[model samples]
Target: MIGFYGDIVFETSNSRILTFSELQRSTASRWAKHEVIGKKPTSEFIGPDLDTVSFTVNLNGQYGVHPRDEMNRWLIKARSGTAETFVIGNKRIGVDKWVVKSVSQMWGVILNKGEVVTGKVDIELEEYVERL
Candidate 1:
């Protein structure tokens, strides 16, 4: 089945559960410390920071409910720092409290009535943690 942001999911299966049409994820995040180096070498390497994971899911073809509703609400929610649970197939634990970073909506075919007959939604998710 597809995935969901917050409480929304795109059901692709004809049976019930929605699956992902296409999913792309960014590599693991790294930590770095920066300091002014006027004289000697800058040595402030304490430890690494929290990891951040990014995912882009494509909503296309006949699968699950149209994700237009969530996409609409995401615009407003993104500003409010809305955190949500993210699950893509077998999701790993501690990979919770996610938030929408950006969205790109592509209209493939539009009708004469100015309605999109075929389109795809690309959602970007970021992992958010409270503390380091």
Candidate 2:
């Protein structure tokens, strides 16, 4: 198993061909600039911004994965604003749960029956923190 986003598992098996690539993570700090009369503006640290993660997943029916079905799962979660735990190699991704920020799909191979045989999905996730 490579990693998992909520209930969607990324793995390779005789009957399932789901895996990820081009995984990228980003972190940022919130800073504010204070204007100065004569000198350079001073900066004030506000806090830490939410971390973001982006990756691409390839789906192929020949490897045992249904592209449309898997893509629907991601769309459903993103539409509902669901926060789910993300794990990769037995390690959690962020400080708290992560929400699906976006899901972009590209259909590569399709048959005459309009069945998608191969496709790729790019997913973006942001850290989810509960309000006190």
The per-prediction tally of clashing pairs is: 10, 0
RMSD of each: 4.0, 1.1
lDDT of each: 0.56, 0.90
List the candidates' TM-scores in order.
Answer: 0.63, 0.95
Weakest 10 consecutive residues of candidate 1 by summed lDDT: 56-65
Best by TM-score: 2
Off by over 4 Å in 2: none
lDDT of 2: 0.90
Clashing pairs in 2: none
Per-residue alpha-carbon lDDT of model 1 for 49-100, expressed as tens digits? 4434444444433444344543455566667778877765557425557777
Give lDDT tens digits, candidate 2, residues 1-132. Answer: 988888998887777768999999999999999999999999999999999999998888899888888888889998999899999989998779999999999998988888998898899999999875
By lDDT, the best candidate is 2
